[model samples]
Target chain A: MIVQTALLIGLVLFSVLAILLRDLLKSAISLAAASLFLGIIFFRMNAPYAGVFEISVVAGLITVLFILTIALTKAGDEVRESRVVNWVFPLFFIAFIIIDALVMKGLLRKIPALASGAETGTFGDVLWKGRTFDLVGQIAVILAGVFAVLALFRKGDKHD
Target chain B: MIILFVALPLVVAGILPLVGKVSRRVVPDLLANAALLFLLVYAAITGRHLIAGGPVLQQLSWFGEPVAIRLALDGFSLLMLLAIALVGLAACLFSIDYMEHYGAKANYYALFLVMIAGMNGLVLATDLFNVYLFMEVAAVASYALVAFGLGRDELEAAFKYLLLSVVATAFILISVAVIFGMTGSLDFAAVAKALQELNAGAAVGVASAFFLMGFGLKAALIPFHAWLPDAHPSAPAPISAVLSGLLIKVSGVYAMTRIFLNVFGLTPALSTVLMSLGALSMVVAAFLALGQKDMKRMLAYSSISQVGYVVLGIGIGTPLGIAGGLFHLFNHALAKGLLFLTSGSVQQATGTRDLDEMGGLAKRMPITAATNLVGALSIAGVPPLNGFWSKLIIIIALVQSGHPVFAVIAVLTSVLTLWYYLLMQRKAFFGKLNEKWAAVKEAPFWMTAATVFLALLCVGIGILFSSTVTTWIQPAADVLADGVHAVIGSWGF
Candidate 1:
């Protein structure tokens, strides 16, 4: 529990750092760290499938993509100060605090218990049998990701 | 198996890249077309059985016990599958010629096939989480397809689409998570049954709001519609056709309707909210389309307006209303897809999408001109066209449901739709031939063939309107009207 709390704090700090960092590369790295923390939390919560996906896809693949995008564009060293964000952050922070408090106090109690179905199945059984279509969808999405990358980076088209 | 509807294209999409590496460009094209054709043929063969079979529920199992990955097919999902297969086939055929210049033909076909797979999964998904996942699959593929051209405008539009879509997906995830937390299962039937017993009005209400925001953004309804105009017009024309014609209806309107009507019983308040959004999108988008100079952009705005008519029909929540909505759904797929493809041909032939830059190409590109005219007049609600019947039904439904003002607005919007489409026709096709495009010939044979096929469907469905409603459309409406419990009972889950 202590480790989970520490991981949660690390997630928040890394996320804030990702947003506030001016250097694009550092921001990308911070975002990856945040993803890593999130994956750990998912694992702690007993959702290994979600945690593995979060680590592999978001922390590993997406972070690599972000770093590559930054490097390919030679944008990592460029940093610009944003007066607008400084002005906006406090208001957002306050709003978030208020919503969090309302949820913790009044709104949280309304949540109902989980609805267990009539049948129970193993995790693999649930995924393969109950959610087969989603697996197909995920494969399509991965293929789309590959094609999108190829389309963006491939050369020799006159339309370019 | 019921899973074949989603699995077939997916399996084909997975192999397309490897096949492309070995063969010429046409290989991917032929293979993708074959896959879509197979699905279309399969749908045609089995559609009757599904509708007659009452509800086809196939559960994946382990240890001889039913498992969570279940697929449910009723009349509604069958109609949607048929629509996806048909429109996807037309888009693929059109892309064969149109995508020749885009380069990376194999990659484009891969993305396109993936999109078809996603839509098929989305429509057939029996669980809330699967719907969300399939929606993302379709959404991500479409985002990449939007940016496929890699032009300045395409990238900008894609970035905007991605950002807004992420927001929408975040909302959808929150709602799904909230529901799962409240009702231990993500299965649609289980949640619906559990929700019925729980005194969770406030929670359901908030989730409904999130769903409306999410799906409304997907559908490009009036208030949440900032991204669609730019995104739709910026993609390759076939992608634009698929986006406007099928994606929004399936992911946005269809998913939203299923959730609101079936999972959450459609209360009067929800009905009012949906009807209001529909009316707003219908009238507002038509007015916006009037002043657009770009041909595809104008058609994009018109899609939003036409979608309003569908939403209005569905929001009325009457049998006639849903029937009208479903009819309009299929009609829009045929007609609007035809219009986008025609615009693409015009753009391909003349090298411009600006209506003002295009004039009197009728002589040079007779097939395109004729097909464009068919699409325009059909969309304008001309008598004996499918659009006319659907719009009339929706308006009549509004009146019968005692919302005379909305009915009046519906009639006015139909006229408004006609005014702009006629404006588009006059400016682009009916004028004296632009000397610049005098040398432009009809689009390549395949493009013309695809457009003509959709055009024929527009005309044929209109002519055979009653038969279509009875066989294809009405059963879908009956499924919606029967509510969640009846559907669940039919599945015997």
Candidate 2:
């Protein structure tokens, strides 16, 4: 329990750091650290498939992509953020944490356990047979993302 | 097949980019428009027969074994499907001409079709997780479409929209997670059954709250509506039409009501909350719309306000009220869709969205002005238009339900709606000719045709409302009026 709590704390800390850090490289690294912590939590919670995806896809592949993109682009003119956001985000964050801490424990106690057993079958079985509709949706989303990239990147495209 | 509703557009979308290489303009245009026309025919004509007996449940079988892609179409989903196809085809037709100068027409059509597929999938989905997945599908496509112009305002608006939308989805996901934990099911019928057996009010309330915030943001309900006025106006005009006319209704209102009325079963408390939110959104957004100078921005706020009317009518939780809400939804989809398309025409001709910039456009573009007036009056709830009947039904339902104050509010907002719409009409089209717009021509054939299509439907539905309501709205309202029985009894997987 202590180890799990520490890991959860690490996840939140790194996530907050990812948002707060000014340096793009540091922010990317912080996000990676957060994802790693989350992946560990998922594994500890018996969701190894989710853990693997979180670590490999998000913590590894996405981090690399972010670093590569950041490396390729020169920093543009410094953009100043609003003063309101600096304080407001943290304020909301703290308030949410407080509310979660107060409400979640009692709420968790009240929630009756699921009437059914845990998800069964292999990952492929679940993917192919249990949730085939998701695959269609995923395909459409990927198609959307690809088309978006193509449309947005098309050159010399100015206001009509 | 019901699956075709999702698969057809997605299949076409997948081919469009490749097809762009061969013939960017003509082929993509024809293919995309053809796909939408097929959908319209399938929904408006074929859908009725399929659902006449009862809900059509589909489970695709590969070879001999059935896979778990469960989709269902009932009266309510059929109504939504019909609305999506109609507005989707109109927007696609409008895009034929309007997207000419924007370039990369194939890519544009591809995204548009994908968005339509997403919406259709959402309505047809039998499970909760699938609903979330499909909503995201539509959302990602819209973010790109909103920023398709690649201008500073477009990019900025898209970014803000993306941020808020992410927040909305987070709340929704959290609610889904909580519900899953308690019920161990994501299918609508199973969840409804589980929730009824459990009777865990506090947890259910939490889930419902998260859902309300999520969908309210999607619907652009007041207080959660900061992103819409920016995002709607920033997109290209046809996109604006779809965004205002269809996306919010589909993703926001439709999703919310389906979950609330069918899956969760609307309690009096939930009903009260919904009505309060509806009243708030309708009243506040109407007032906000009254002050806008940008033509599309005004329309965007009006979308929010009208959506409020939809929620209010549905919130009454009666057959007549649900019918009123749904009828308003369909009418607003047509009228608002028409208004936005005409706004696009005006923008294209004049190169501005500022209503105060010019006058006397009626002389130059008579059809556009006429269509624009039709849209404005319909939305403003003027007589002999579809909007009038729907609003009246809602008001009457409200009074019968002992919510006279809300009824009064709805009436006053209608007047406010008329006031601003007239202000827009007078400022842009009525007065002395704006010398700068003298050379502007009527919109190209396709654009004019699209506007006319929706405009005529508004008038036709108005005149033939009883028949239209009997054929379309009654079935849908009956299903919703059935409450939990609509799902638990028939939607078993």
Candidate 3:
């Protein structure tokens, strides 16, 4: 429990640093680390399937996409100058976070008890029997995403 | 029938490019438009289904599990599907000429069909994971469509949209996973049942927060609206029509409404949050629009403002208010679709989207100019136009709900909407004819035809508001007013 709490704290700290850091590449990497930590937490909480997906899709695939964007746009080396507004945002964000944390503490304490022994059935059992339409909908989403990415990269030769 | 709505588009999207390769023109266009038209007719014929009486278990097992992908078309789903199909059919018709300038017609049509498929699937979906999936599908297509030009502006805009959209999707996915964890179910009805029986506490709150942010970004509500102006204007015109007209509404507003009203059960706090967001977008977007010099960019900002109205109406959380919101949604789609297509025509003719550079286009392109005027007036809430009736309904609904202040602000914003749209009209169509545009003729036959058709529909729907309300708007509104109780009772779980 102590180790897990320490890891969660580390994850939160890393996420903050990722957003705050100047270097885009480093920020992207830090976000990946944060996602990895989040996946660990998910697994620790007994959501093994979700944890696996969190790591593979969010930590792995999305981080790569962000890195690609940084590379494609040549934005990695761009310096983000510190400004009064930037300073204000962090201060405000921190205040909001503190308030949210206070409100969430009690709620977080009860989650484990709520989720414990919840996964008696296969993932498919709940996903298919209960939510089959959603699965098909998700497939459509993936197809749309794939098409959008391809459309973006296609050559712009005028056909007219 | 429900499955067909999703499957037809998916199958055609797959084969569209190959058909283009063979016929290279007519076949691809015909097939795509025909498919959507068929779906539109299908949805109209089926009407609303009572969950108890309808065939609910239309599944075919996959991988030795009874986990076949299913689609259940309820009133809410049917209403959204109808909008998509109607707008999609018109857009496809317009694209015949509009997309002639853009190369790879087959690929373009393929993406278009896929987006329609994704949206149709999204509306029909009953599962939480599938919603996320279809949302991404639509988002991905829109990102590409936004960047279709491959110009510097298009690429930059697409990238910005892509970044924000990915973040939104991630947030939504995390929330869905949380819900799955909590309820141990991925179905909408099942999750609702679980939530009602359990004291969801913080998890529900957290999940709801994530959904609001994720879908909020998709909706392009105030703070999350940074990408919309850039993305909407950067896309090819028909795409702009789709992006502003249907894409944002389906992927953002419709999704948010479904999840909140049906899945999560709208709470007072959530209602407040929605209303505030709506009010912010309504006011802020209008102010920003007044400052734009580019015609399409201004329209983009106006789209954001119009979306605010829909959100505001829904936020009221009254039966009449919800109906008003849905009515506004239908009107906005038609009017905005017409406006974008006309702007496309103008751009195509004069090689510019800048309001400052255009003047007295009414002489050269009478049809396009007239259509633009009708669209402008309609969107501005001029009486006898569709926009006016919807705005009137929303305002009345607001007053009936005891939010006279919001109603007043809504009226003020309507004036502002008229101001900007008239400004666009004056600069682009009414002043002295720009001598440089002497060579500009009416848009090519097909483009002129499509714009005229849409413009006429806008006027017709407005003039015949009572009839339209009776047939389409009221049924759609009824679904929302029915709310969670309707969903729960109908499902008979």
Candidate 4:
């Protein structure tokens, strides 16, 4: 329980720091850190698959993308300070969360219970049976990416 | 099978690069044209079947349980597919010669086919998750197509489109996640049933708002129209035609109307909101279009304006209104596609896209001039053109529905459309010869052929408006007019 609480607090702290950081590169790193903490929290809650995706995709791949963009653009630190969080807003947010949690607890009692094994499905079955068209969509997206990169990096007359 | 509508293009897209390398001209062009022709013929047969009151559902299953992906053949999806196939065919024809200037014809055709597959999937999808996924597919292809030239302007426009589209997708995914959390299902029928049981509280309201905003961005409605003027004009002409003529309708207007009318029965509040958005896009984009010096940019803005008429018509929630909106959808596709192709021809010959630099091109490029005149008159709502009947229907529907103020605004916007199009004509094709383009020949035969085909459609559909409406549009509108419960019943889920 104590470790779970620490992970939760780390998630909140890194998320805020990510937004508050002036340098975009540092902000990206902070965001990755927050994603890592969230992944730990998910694993603690028995969702290993979700945790794995969060760590690999959000924390790993996305951080590399952000770093590449920063390097290519040669961007400097943002001049303006972030005003995303303030004292009154946090207090109101905390109060709203409390009320929402209580209301959700009441609502949960009214919902039907899950059937046996209803919450689980094999990955292949879930993707093939549940999202056939999405697979087609993913194929299109990957092909588009391939062609887009080819078009962008083609060797030819540099005429604009 | 409905799957063939999506699969044919994809399979061809997968094989195009290999074939293009061998014979860039013959192999790729023939295969692309053949694929599109097959899809068009298939769409026609299925649309006729649906029009004659045929079967509405086509299910594909794997092992034991039925798959979540369902493809529906309703009147509405049939009409949309027909529009997509027709526009895609015309654009493909135009691109045969137009894409030669930019090498790698194979890559271009490959991406184009993928985009068509994505749109076809989007229209036929029966689940919310598939809708979002197909929307992403279409969006991704379009971003690349917009930047295909790799020029400075093209890259900038593509990046802007990409950033905004990502934001829109995020919003849509959030809404989808919320609905899935509440309902434990992704299929449209299942979600509707669950929401019905749950009494559809604040969560549904929030999701609906997100849907409107997200789809609104894709539609390039007034508030989220920043990327269109840049991106549409920056892409090659055929891509511009496809993007303005078909993509927005499939990914934005069609998705929004289907979800609102079929999934979450339309309330007065949602109807009013839709109408207001339509009105705002109509007036604002018209004014913005009026001052544009670039030819394609003006047409892009005009698309947002025409889409307004459609949204306004559907928002009225009457049968006449919905039919009028749908009719406008078909007519606008032909007229706008024709105009963009004509602009491409002029640009190809004159080496410029600025309207200010063009003059009296009729003497040099008669085919382009004549076809462009037809397209311009059609879009400007001349009495003999298709745009006239659709606008008249929408305006009359507005008046009949007791929204006289919107009717007046619609009329004023029509006049504004006419004024700008006439200005474009006078500047580009009617005045004294520019002398620089005196030796410019008419666009190549295929380009002229494509433009002329769509031009004839603009006039033909106008003259045959009644038959066209009865045969094509009314059945689609009937699907929307039936409301949510009837739609769910018809799905037989």
Candidate 5:
């Protein structure tokens, strides 16, 4: 449990750095890594299916898409816009408020209660018996996604 | 039979390109329209009931436990299906000639049909995950359609749309994951049942925020509307018609309404959030639209504004409000579809989408001019048109619910809606014929036919609204009014 908390803290720190990083590619990779760590935490919490899906879908597929978009757009050189100091004060103020709320909300206490006696069947049991329609819907979404990407990337058509 | 509403479209959409490959030019157009017509007929016959004693459980067993992939049709789904089918048939018919300018007729039809299939699947989906999948299907096709022109602007707009949409999907997926974590169920009925068992708090608040942002983006509400003005106008005219007429409503607004109302139960805070967002989009988009010179761009903004009305009405969470909202949805689809198609016709004849570039086009394209006028007046809430009735109902409901301020805002926005629409009319259609467009003829027979059909339907529905309400609008409203409890009760889970 100590190690898990440490890993989560590390992930949160890395994710903040990632968002502020100079290199887009490095940011993407760092974000993916953070997602991986978060997935691991989910697994430690006994949500193996969600953990796996998180690593595979969010970290793997979406990260690849982001990279492809970055590559396609030729955005290698980072645009370092000057930051507004005024913005930072409010941003940190909001962040502190959120942090305070998080600590006071008893969320940590609730997590263990949720973890106890949670369903432990394979991903199929929850997906089919509990949420089968979502799977079918996801398939439909993937089909649309694939087609849209194909249309954008289609070659040798110069009718514009 | 319920499944066929989705399956028939999927099968036909898949086979359409191949069929087009074999047939003569006219056959593909006829077949596509005929297919939608058949689906429309099928839905009408099936009416509002769930397919009784049908295969309620079809477990593929591939993913592990026998997960039943279910599709159920109810009044709300049926109404939306009918709307998609009706408008889709008209768009397909109009495209027969409009698409002649573009060379890839087969591919265009294929994408169009696939989008229809996705929308059908979305409306009929009883499960939350299925909603995501179907939403993607529609979203992806829309992205491709937006970029179909392959112009620099088209590519730019499509990319922006794709980026924002991906973010929205990610938000929705995360919410779905959280909901599954909370309830251990993905089916809408099952999720609602489980949610009732759990206490509402921060976790649910987080989930609701995810849904709000995700679906809000899809619906193009105020803060999330940056992509819409570009994306909607960038598409080819038929595709624009579809985007404005149906896409945003189905994937964005409809899905949000279904999930929030039927699945998660609309709490006071959420309803307030929806209403405020709706009001913001309505006022802001209308004001922004009033300053635009591009005719289609202005209309695109107007679409966002009108959608605000629908959302606001639904957000009120009264039976009358929901009914009014759904009624407005139907009317907006017709009016907006007609307007977009007519704009396409105008663009084709004049070779520009700029309102400033057009003058006195009414003389040359009389059919388009008349229909565009009808659409404009209808949208602007002129008396006896469909828009006025729906807007009136919404205002009445608002006043009845003791929200006089919102009712006043709704009224004021109707005038604002008129201001931009009239500005659009004066600049594009009402002035003297431009010398450069002296040779411009009316849009071809089919496009004119489609525009006229929708225009007439707009009037017909307005005049015969009482019967239409009794038959269609009331049932759909009842579904939403029944709320989360009725939905779970219906399943007998």
Candidate 6:
């Protein structure tokens, strides 16, 4: 319980820092650290597949992508963000914590511990048989992302 | 196969860019339009027959073995599928001419098809997790489409939209996680049954709140509406049409209504929340719309106001209310789609979206002006137009349900709606010819044809409202009227 609590706190802290930080590189690294903490938590919870994916894709692969993109591009003129987000976020965060402290414990306790169903299978089985539709959705998302990149970065023609 | 609704578009989208290199215009246009036409025919002609017996479930067997690719189509989903295909075909047709100035027609068509496939998949999905997944699929496609023009304003709008949308999806993911932990299943039928057995009200309430906030952002309800006015007007015209007319309805309203009414069973509190949000958006957005100089921006605000009416009727939780809400949803989709396409025509011809700068465009582009009038009148609830019937039904439903105050609000909002629409019409289309637009010409064949088609439907459906309601709206409303039993009983595999 102690270790899990510490991991979760680390996750939340890094995530908060990620949003608050103004520097893109620092923000990206903070996000990576948050993902690392989350990946560890997933591992401790006995979800090896989720843990592996979280660590590899989000923490490792995505972080590298973010950093590489940052390296490739030069910073433009400094852009000032809205002042509203500064206070609003922290206010909402503190209020959510209060609600969590007051209500979530009891609320969570009342929920029944349902037995695991199709998830109690091998990773291949789970991916292919238990959740085939998700694969189709993932494919669509990737296709959209790729096409978006192509369309956004295409040679300026008549649009010129 | 019901999978065709999703798979056909995806397959076509996958090959479109490759096909584009061989023949940029003709081949890609024909292919994309053909794909959408096929889906439209399938949904309009064959869908009702398939579901005549009951909800039909598709469990595919690949290589003679069963897979977990489960999809279901009932009255509710079929209605949404038909709407997507019809509006998708219209917008795609509009794009053929309108997008000629913008390059990469093939890639644009591909992303559009992907977005359609995502919405179809979302409606057909029978599980909570799939809902989130497909929602993201559609969302990713839209973010790109919004920024496809790659201008500074377009890029900024897309970025803001993307940021807010990520927050929305995060809330949804957390809610889904909580629900899965509570019920040990993501399937709609299983979760509905489990939730009933558990009766864990507070946890369920938390999940419901998250889902409400998330879908509310997608729908651009009152408090969460900051991103929409910018995003809708920034995109290319066909995209603007699809975004306002169809995307928000599918991702925001359809998803929320299905989850709340069917899987979770709408409580009195939830119903009240829905109604309050609806009324607030109705009054507020209409007022905001009255002040806009930008034509598409005004239409965008009006989209929010009309969506409010749909939600208000649905929130009444009566069968008549559901039917009214749905009929209005369909009406708004057609009318708004036409209005946006015509606005695109005006924009393309005049090189501006500011209503103040436009005048007597009727002389140059009579077809566009006339179609714009039909659409504006229809949406403003003028007589013998489809929007009138739907709005009247909603107002009547509110009064019948003893919500006289809300009924009055609905009526007043309709009047306010009429005022702004007339303002838009007069400023842009009715006045004496402005010398600036003296050289403007009618929109190309495809763009005019698409707008004409939707205008005719608005008039036709208005005249034939009763039969249309009996055939399409009743079945969908019946499903929601069944509430939790709709899924817990009939949807079980």
Better of 1 and 5 by lDDT: 1
Q: Sort by lDDT, best first: what order?
A: 2, 6, 1, 4, 5, 3
Query: Once model 4 is optimally superposed onto the true structure by TM-score, how far is the C-alpha of residue B69 displaced, in angstroms?
Result: 3.5
In angstroms and one decimal each, the interface RMSD of every candidate reads: 2.6, 2.0, 3.3, 4.0, 3.9, 1.6
Best by lDDT: 2
Candidate order (TM-score): 2, 6, 1, 4, 3, 5
**Model 4: clashing residue pairs?**
none
Off by over 4 Å in 2: A74-94, A157-160
- In model 4, the runs with Cα more than 4 Å from the true position are A1-28, A41-47, A61-118, A157-160, B62-68
The TM-score obtained for chain B by all candidates, in the order given, is: 0.98, 0.99, 0.96, 0.98, 0.96, 0.99
Candidate 4 CAPRI classification by DockQ: acceptable
Q: Which pairs of residues collide in model 1?
A: A114-B184, A115-B183, A115-B184, A129-B69, A130-B68, A130-B69, A131-B69
lDDT of 1 by residue, A1-160 (tens): 6797578768876787688777788889999999999999988877787789899999999999998998899844557857755765566555755775676465477777555543357778767766665676677778778878887887867443
Global CA lDDT of candidate 6, please?
0.93
| Residue A42 of model 3, lDDT score | 84
How much is B30 displaced in model 5, in angstroms? Answer: 3.5
**Rank order by DockQ, top first?**
6, 2, 1, 3, 4, 5
> Could you tell me how far off, in angstroms, the CA of residue A148 lies in candidate 4 after the best superposition?
1.9
Per-structure clash totals for the candidates: 7, 0, 5, 0, 6, 0
TM-scores, all models, native as reference: 0.93, 0.97, 0.87, 0.90, 0.87, 0.96
Docking quality of model 1: it rates as: medium
Q: Poorest 10 consecutive residues of model 2 chain A by lDDT? A: A76-85
Better of 2 and 6 by TM-score: 2
Return whichever of 3 and 5 wins on DockQ. 3
Decide which is better by lDDT, 2 or 4: 2
Residue-level lDDT of model 6, residues B1-493, one tens digit each, is 9999989999999999999999989999999999999999999999999999989988988999999999999999988998898888999999999999899999999999999999999999999999999999999999999999899999999999999999899989988988998888999999999989887898899899999999999999988889999999999999999999998999999999999999999999999999999999999999999999999999999999999999999999999999999999999999999999999999999999999999888888999999999999999999899999999999999999999999999999999999999999999998899999889999999999999989998999989999989888899999999999989888887
DockQ of 2: 0.66
Q: Tell me the TM-score of model 1.
A: 0.93
Task: Identify the candidate with maximal TM-score.
Answer: 2
4 versus 5: better DockQ goes to: 4
Error of 2 at B15 (Å): 0.6
